[model samples]
Structure formats: structure tokens, C-alpha cells
Target: MQERNVDIAIIGAGSAGLGAWHAARQHTQSLVLIESGAFGTTCARVGCMPSKLLIAAADVAQQARDAEGFGVKVSGVTVNGPAVMERVKRERDRFVGSVISSMSRIEDEDRILGAAHFEDANTLVVGDHTRIHAKRIVIATGSRPTWPDFLNGAGDRLIINDDIFDWDDLPESVVVFGPGVIGLELGQALHHLGVRVRMFGVGGGIGPLGDPDLRKLADQEFNADFPLDPDANVLRVELEGEQVAVTFHCRDSDTEKTERFDYLLAATGRRPNVDRLELKRTGLALDERSIPRFDRLTMQCRFDDGSLAPIFIAGDANQDLPLLHEASDEGRIAGDNAGRYPDIRAGRRRTPLAVVFSDPQIASAGVSYAELKRRDESLASIAVGEVSFEDQGRASVMRQNRGKLRLYAEHGSGILLGAEMFGPRAEHLGHLLAWAIDQRLTVERLLEMPFYHPVVEEGLRTALRDLNVNLRRGPAITERCLECGPGA
Candidate 1:
């Protein structure tokens, strides 16, 4: 193989790899990026953008159907599945094209369109032609949807996120096997779009939410839209005549349940795409899950010597935080540190933020209620405050009054530790909470801030007020200013 030398080499052309390339370029120009598949990341191609497009179409149909509650009688509401899918694909391709174009800005010589495997700690062999020797390497190879062993019998009947958006026509009914973020979102969207959708999961939780209360609310709401049987252990899957039959044991009720659908969509989760890399040749030992032990603060891989290597892993490949924003942040950290190498600097960790884009969106930031309850040191000091949107003015006006909002704080310090909510516009509320928690803002300080009238944010204020009461920590700024500061 022809050998090439570079200051840095990045694997994967997805968000994380692109991020690393962008940041690493600041430090060195002698670098290369290797990708095996489409240049666009998962989010643009399948995860976020395309799914949101589908969800938006479903939302329009759902809104039209639900318009009667607002004294607006609407008739003849129907969704064209093929048309919706067409639009989603059209827009999705645009997004993917944009990502590819951005990467195309790099010189053609630096971009290798092939799979790469590690030949040694500092060498990577691409396909059969080129071998790259780099001072530092960043592995942002990303992840792929996993198909369980039980699904082997289904063969061509199995569906996955990678190919879901490419369907010419929507299935009449589908069995979503996994109630994770993707499963829940797509299941609900398909249901709204007139597809009979049922979802089952091996975990008790719905979506990615950790807060039990929020999960319960989401469970209720999502179940109303589609059949969601979580904590279900799928036993076997096979073809029954024309449909796919699934046999699963429901953990909650301790019973076996069988269901049939036109097709089976597996949203079970994803596995890091590292197996083909031949990482063992690089002297890096992988854990049971094939993940390299790395420092979260430094993003450096732990070598066989138990010392840090010049290699870094980020994004979904690391499987630490699978969200796009977190992946991008991790990529930057990995790139910065890998470019700096021996002079690596520690990166700041942001407060955790997770959101599931289902109806009455589910969101959480920082220490969730379940997390605090699990920690002995924090449980006693934990306090929860909530506001129901069932009767909230804005929710009622919008005819979307169906969920709740909650804020968690430390009782003694009254600091906003985390928040979990399932309500209309919870995405925005979740972002607000994430920013405040990142700033270490106290509940009292948050209350002192302005809350606009007749807005969804008022619901947030109400929760904070309740939180303040639970903590018994009043506002830092008094309601009265005592005659306008000096001498007004």
C-alpha cells in the first residue's frame, strides 16, 4: 500500500467527524477524513431532520383532526402518505446535499471514500491502496441501527431507520419493536398519518426520559395515540403468511403477547460502527460492548499501557451521548485535544439535555428526578415542583391541555438542578432549563426574571413558584423596591 503522512486523520464523515475536521483544520492543514458511506450524518439523513419532517406532516394532520375541540369543525381530513414521504425525502435530500457540499469544500486529495482499518497505533490502511500515518487520530465513525438475533427469521420483512424514509408507500400497519426515541417518534407519526402503529420495548421507560412522572404522562399520551407496550422482551419473530408475527413477554404483567403487523420496524437502538476498524491492531482494548475506555473530560482513548493515547473518539461512536448537539460538542473537544496532542486541554462539560420529539414533547436536563432519587446523598435534599397544563390558559386556548411540567431543585440551596416536562412547547422550555442549569441559576433568581403574560412560559414560572414553596426558599429580590432605589 502507498503510505501517506499527516498531522491528523479523522474517520467518519458524519457530524462528529466533520466537527473534528473543522476544528482540527485550525491547528493543522496536513490532515485527511475517511468515510465509508454517505457524507451526510445520521441526523440529516435519518435521525433528526427527516424524522422531524415526517413528524411535522403528521402534526398537520393531527391538528386538523383535533380542531373540533376549539369550536372549529373541520371535515374531510386525510393524509397522502406517498406525498408526505415524497416531501420528506425531497427536503431530506436537500439537507443531506448541504452537508455533503460543506465537506466538499475540503481538497479532493484529503477526502478518502473508503473504509479504513487500523494497522497499528499510528497507522490506518484505507481499502487496499493507501496507508496513512498520523500523529493523532479521531474516531467519529458514528453508529448504526442494530437488528436483534430474534429477527433473523423475518429476513426481507425487517425495516430499519436507514431505509424507512425511502419507502414508496406507507405500510397499512407496523409493529415498532423498541419504544426508544426513534421508535416512539416514528410510531406516533405513523399513527397520526393514518397508519395503524403499535410499539413494544424491553425497557419500562417511554422515550429517552428518565423522570418517572414525565414518563408516565408520556406513556399515557403516546398510548392514546398508538399502542405502546414497554418492558416487553421480544422472544421470537417470524413470517406468518403475508404479515410478520412477533411473540414477546411483557415484563409488567408477566405474560406472553403475540402481535402481527404488515411489517416490523426495528428501532431497538444502535451499535457503534467500530468492529470493521480492527482497533485491536492499534493496541486499544475494547470493553464488553466494544467501546474503548476514554476520559469524558479529555476525550482521549485509554491505550493498553493504561495511559492516554493521541487518539480520541466522539459522537455516537463513543455512545456516551447520542444526541446531535452533544455529538457536535464532543467532536470539537476530540478535535481540539487531538490536534493539541501532548498539550491536550480539558474540555468543559455541558449540562445534559435530552429531548424526545413526540406530541406534548418530552424533555429533561441535568439531574433528572430518577437520578436524584437513586443517589443517597441527593435524594433527601431533592425537591420537586410541578404545574399541570390541563387547565393552563395557554394550553386551553390552544386546545392542547394534556401534560405536566416539573422542576427539580435542592431544598436547602434552592438551586435549579434539573427539569423534566411533557407538555406543549416543552422543547423550548427544556432549552431554557438547560441554559439556566448550565449557568447554575437558583430557583429564586429564575423567579425574579420576567415571565410574559398568556405564554407557555408562564407555566414554567408557575412550576418555579411551586418549587420555591417546596424549597421554602423565597425570591432573592423582594416584590417591593422600597421607593425606587435612591430618591425617586
Candidate 2:
């Protein structure tokens, strides 16, 4: 067995671990990154990268299908699911290969291909052969798709997000369980590939914390193409020969129904990949959800001894926001704090900016209206304005007019609290709102800022104008005035 010492040892080579490794690399040459599998876990291999490729293909297919409506004569159009899957796999492999080749540039000793478990506060045993002693250790093990016991028997018949990308042939029909971000994104992609996708979940929208209006818009758009059972709760999964059958109960009807599909995908959710690590050996305790207990601010794992241990956690393992961007940000913070002073201070991080990659993409940041109302009774906010795609000339030109933009600002302080956008080019519109919310920009500043006219972003200008007008009218304006007043 070989023993080595390093400044930082990062477990898992996914987004968060990679972020921590890159951040720590700039400060110290002695950094070790360990992974059970190859680099680029779900995000690169299956979650975001491959899924987006499939979505892009679906977009082309949809455009071709809709071209006839715009007086563009189109010949017979056919969707080749296998070909689409092949292209998706090719692109995914290319990206993953690029990442792996990049990792090769680092010293061989710095990268370990094995599972790692903490031996002590600052020591880790890798693959039962190599021992790594570090001043600080970071756990960026990420997460795995969660499937309930009820679906256990389905076994090989059911696929997870990680398994879907490996398939060479696409299923003619897919029943996706759970309405989380993955479910919606993959569901829409599969549907666009001509798969009859029936998404099961009673949850309102894709992401649990996405803006409600955005959720409604997604439901409206996707429901037109695929069956979105919002209140459907899957109770069991059974393998019937070549097909998988799902039995679910509807919340509204309280009746059970069974649906058969060529493939069953469990997008139920993800749990931190901590089970195999045997964390109990190191005296680290897991919460009820099986996630490690850590200080949310510092990303430091809490210990019984008044002193903090060097074992830190980031990304999905911390069970914070599971978005790749948020995880990487947390990893950078954790890696920096781990190597530096013990009590390094930093401001609290607010709710992260999140987006759902769907046809009509959804984006949201800051406190939600429902959450704010729960916390503060007297809390008041002015909805600056909501401009539909129908109102945007760019959307009209592109014939992608199927979304809206909305901004919310504090009633008194005028600081931007949150924003939501749905429809074509919603993701691009979200970036501006994300910057505004992150900077806590005032409505006055936002209104004064120059935005290109005749663009989708100009919708923000329309929204800000509405907010300015409402500010001029006192606080006593009724909901009717807010909706359809002379100025409105």
C-alpha cells in the first residue's frame, strides 16, 4: 500500500469535486481527487449534457413539424429515435472524453481511480490499497437516482438518469416517475423524440422550488404534447415481459390506474452517495435523509469535539441546491475555507438561481412568494410587470411566442427580490434577472439601465415600466387596478 500526503483530498470527480480540485489547485500543488467511477458523473454523462443534446434534437424535430403551419411546405418528416440517441451519445462521449483528457494533464499521483472512505478526521483509505493523509478532506461524492422499494422488483426493467444515456436504442414509450427537473427535461426530450411519454407526479411542476407561474406555463406547454399527471403518485412498478408497468394513484380521483410502457425511468429524486463510504467508521453521523451533517455556511462537517474536522462536504452530498452551478460554487467555497483559517468568515449565501431546461424553460431566484408570505405577514412586494411572448416582437418574428416574463421588487425598498420567465429564450432572459437579484439592484436602477429594444429582453423594460407606474400610484390600489387600471 502506498501512503501519501496532500493539502486537499477531494472525493468524487464530478462538478463540485472538480470545482474544489481546480480551486485548490491554484493554491496548492498537493491535491488528490478520488472517484469511484470515471470523471463526469450524472451532469456530464447523463443529467445536463446528454439531456440537452436530446432536447436540442427534439427542438429541431418540432420546428420541422410546425413549419407547415407557417406556409413553409415540408415533405414527409420522420423522427429516428435511434439516430437521435446515437448523436446524443456521440456528443456526450466527446464531452466526457475531453474532460478525461484534460484530467490527464494533472500528475498521475494526484488523480486516483477508486472509492474513498474517511479513515479519520484527515485521512482517507482509497480502494483498500492507497492511503491519503491530507490537512483537509472534501466530500463531493454527489448523488444517485432514488428508487423506492416498491419498484425494486422491476430492477433491470427500470432505468435511471444514469442508465438512460447508455441505451443504444430509444424506447417507443417511456413512463417517467417524479416531476423533478430531471423528469421534466428528459420527459420533454423523449416526447420530442416521438416517444409517448407519460410523466407521473402530482407535484405542480418540474423542480420542487421553481416559480409557480413558470411551473404553470411548463405544464401548459408540455401537456399539449405529453400527458402530465400532476397529482399522480406511482405506487408500484412491475416488469411484464418486455415492458414495464406502473401502477399509480391519482390525488384528485383517489383511484388507481396502471400504465404500461416500453421503458420505465425513475426520476423520483437523488440521495447522497454516502452509503458505500461507511461513514460510521469515522464517527461522522448522517441525518435522517442520510446526508452528512455540516455547517451550511463553511461546509465543514460538525464533530463532537468542540473543534471542527477537516472533512468537509459540498455539492449534492451537502443536500443543498443540487444544481451543478450551485454545487460548484459551494465546492469552491469549501475548498478555499478548508485550506485557510478555521474560522474564516463569509456572508451567508442566499437561495441560488435555478432554471429548468424545458421547452418553455423556467428560471427563478431569491425567496418565492409562498415562502415570503409564510415568513412575514406584513411583507409586501410590487410585481413590476409581466409581459407575454405575444407582446415581444422578437418572439413574434421567431414564431416562438409561448412564454412570459415577470419581476418582483420590494414595495418600500424597491430592491429586486425575484424574477420568473417562461417561453422562448426564457433562459437568456433569466441571466439578466439573476444578475439583478444577485446584486440586489433597485427597481430605479433597473429601469434606468439600457436594454436593447425589439428584443425579448425589452420585456423587462415593459415590466419595469409597470412597476414604476404602480409606485406612482399609492399603496391603496386594489387588485383590479393592479391588473387592469387606466395606467396598467
Candidate 3:
């Protein structure tokens, strides 16, 4: 058997793993990275890049159809599904290739092209013959889409995000299960591209907006494109001829409605890839969720004696924060801490930012109003400022005013705590709010910043102005950084 030794070993060559590698390589050369699949990360190959490509294509088609609203009647619009898919794959392949090319710059010996299983806290066995003794191990194996037991008989009818982008043509009709991020994004995109799509979610809202008000607004805009059943509780599957039959039952209704579709997309959610690594061999305790316990701040696992073990978990595999940016940050923390083991240090986490890239784009930063209200009983001390695109000048000019923006802050402190919105270019607005919250900026401070005229950002200013009205400590807004004397 072949044996080797490394100071730090990273499992899974996805975004989190790559981030860990990049960070740890700076401190030590005694590092090895292991992968059993394609070199490119999930975001590049399946999750983010390819999905955005398809969404961009669908956006074009949607714009063409909506051109009549602007008093410009354009006709002869035809969507070639195969051609669109071709371009998506061609472009997606280029992205995947770039990721692989960068990784290839590492020496071949440092990259082990196989799955790794833990033999002990400091030992890993790769395949049958190659054994690696790592002083510290960083688990960044990421996650995979999960299928429910109902899909057991779904032979050729099931599709997940991993394979959706590879299709050469669009399905005639599809029933999307779980109206989370993947389901809503793909469902809306497919509907825009002339596919008949029906989306089902367990709750009354789509995506992870976390606020009831924002979810209602998002559902309204999303339903305009396709049939959305956000309250579907039970889904039963059966076969109907060559097609798959699905019965959706809403929580309030006793009736069962069955529909047959050419495709069934299971976007329920994703689970950490922890089981495959044989974590039991590591001698770490597993929680009820079958996940190894690790410190959220330092990303370090503890031994039975409460001492830090030479192990770390990061990215989706940790099941804490699954977003790409969060994974990258966690990976860096894990790698940095792993290399400097026995002297573990916690790094500051980034401000919470999540986005759903559907039309109007649902995004949020920091804590949501719902979360604050759930934990805090003093609702009067919390203030919410809202601005609707229905009346915004820029939105009206472009005929794209079908959403709302909400900003949440403390009533007395005027500290921007969180923001939730469904508005045009909300992704950009969300980032601004995230940075402001991260900096602990006050409402008065944000108002002092410049806001241009006739832009979506003006809507943010409007919301901030409304929020400032409820601040108890000071005036709603002051124009200057410091309360200035009259030209003295």
C-alpha cells in the first residue's frame, strides 16, 4: 500500500475545498487536496453559473413578450430551446474549464484524484491502496440534492439542478417540487422560456424570504409567470403511462389534485455529504442530525476531553451556511484554523447576505423582521420602512414596478438591523444594506450619503427616510454628517 503524509488535507475540490486550499497553501506546502469527481466546483458546474445563464436567456424571452406594455408591439418572437441549451452548455463549459485550469497549476502529487475516508482523527485512506496521514483534516465535501421516498419509482422522469442544465431542449410541461431557491429560479425561468411549469412549496411562500409580507409580494410576481401552489403539503407520486403523475394536497383542502408532466424536478433541498466519509472512524461525536460537532466560530472539532481535535468542517458539509460566499468564508476559516491547530483563532464572519435571482430578485441582509419579532416581544421598538415600485418613477418609466422594498431597524438606536425586499435590482440593494449593517451604520449616517435621481436606489432613500421617522433618539434625518451651524 502506498502511504504519504501531509500537514493539512482538504476533502472535496468544490468551492469550499478550493477556498481552504488557497488559504492554507499560503502558510504551508505540506498540503494535499482530494477529489473524486469533476475538478470545477458546484457553483461553476451546476449551481450558480449555469443556472444564471439559463435565467439570462429566459429574461430575454420575457422582455420580448412584455415589449407591448411599452407601446412597442413587436411580433414574430420564437424561442429555440435546443439553441438556448446549446449556448448555456457552451458557456458553462468554458467556466468549468477555467476552474479546472486554475487547479491544474498545482502539482499533480498534491492533488489526489479520489474519494477519502477517515481511518482515525489524523489518518485518511484513499480508495484501497493509497493511505494518507494528515496532521489536520478539513472537510469541505459540500452537498448534493436530495430526493424524497416518493420518487423511488421515478425512473427517467426525475430531474435535479445537477442535470437540468445539460438538457438539449426544454420539457413541454414540468411540476416543480419544493419552491425553494432552485425550484423558484428554474420554474420561473422555464415558464418564461415557453415551458408549462407548476411550482409546489410546503408553505405559503416561495424561496427563503423569511418575511410574510415579502413572500406575498414575491408570490404575486412569481405567479404572474406560472402556476404556483405555495401551500402544497403532501405530494404523492404514481405512474401514468409513460409520464409521471403527481398529486398535490394543500393543507387546507381535503381534495387531491393529480397532474401528469413530462418532467418532475425535485428541488426539495440539499443534505451534507457527511455519510460517505465514514466519520465514525474519526472518534468525534455526531449529533442527532448525524453531523459531527464543530465550533461555528473557529470551525474546529473537539475531542472527548474538550481539547481541539485535528479536524475541521466547513461549507455545505457543515450544514450551517450553504450559500457560495458563506462556504468560501467558512473554508478559509477552517483552513486557517486547521493549519494553525492547537492555537485555534476565530475569524469574524461576514454580514449575512442571501439572494434569489428570480425576476425582481428576492434578497435579504442581516436579520429579517419575522426573525426579530419571533425572538423579541417588543414590536413597537422595531420599525419597518417600506417603498413600493408600483409608484416609483423609475419603475413606472420602465414598466417594471411590481415589487416592494422594506428596511428594518431599531426604533431608538436607528441601527440598520436587517432588510428584506422584492424589487428591481434587489441584489445590488441587498449588498448595500449588508455592508451598512456589517459596519453598524445608523439611519442618520446612511441618509448623509448621496443618492442619485431617477434610480432604483432612490427607493432605498425613501424607505430610510420613512424609517428615520420613528427613531426616538434624534430627528428623522440630518442632511450633514454633523449638525452644522448656519453658515457661521
Worst 10 residues of 3 by lDDT: 479-488
What 10-residue stretch in candidate 2 is worst by lDDT?
A: 479-488
Candidate 1 structure quality by residue, lDDT tens digits, 432-460: 99999999999988987986657778778
Residue 64, candidate 1: how far off, in angstroms? 0.8
Instruction: Assess candidate 3 and give its TM-score to the true structure.
Output: 0.94
- Per-residue C-alpha lDDT of model 3 across residues 1-488, encoded as one tens digit per residue: 78999999999899889989998887899999999787899999998999999999999999998899888898857889999999999999999999999997679999998878998989999888789999999999999999778875556788898788889998898888888889988888988899888888776767878777888888777777677878865567776767778877743577778788888889999999988898888788788877889898988887666777889999999899899999999999999988877778997899899999898788889987767888786777788888887877677777878788888888777899999989888889999999999999998899888876667787788788778876676755634212322110
Q: Give the TM-score of candidate 1.
A: 0.94
lDDT of 2 by residue, 1-488 (tens): 99999888999888888878887777778888898987765677877899888889888988888898789988967888778879989999998887777777678878898988877777889997899998888899998888767766575778888778887877789888787788988888888878889987754655544456666776677778788877667777888888888888864687998888888788888888888776776676567876678877878876655466677889998778788888888788787776674645452565557777887777776666556667665544454556777656667767877877766777777778877776777677677787788888877777668655457766666677666555534443223223422212
Q: Which one wins on TM-score?
A: 3
Q: Give the poorly placed runs of model 2, Cα more than 4 Å off.
A: 208-213, 233-236, 248-257, 284-286, 341-351, 377-384, 470-488
Q: Each candidate: what lDDT?
A: 0.85, 0.76, 0.85
The alpha-carbon RMSD values of the candidates against the true structure, listed in the order shown, are 4.1, 3.9, 3.9
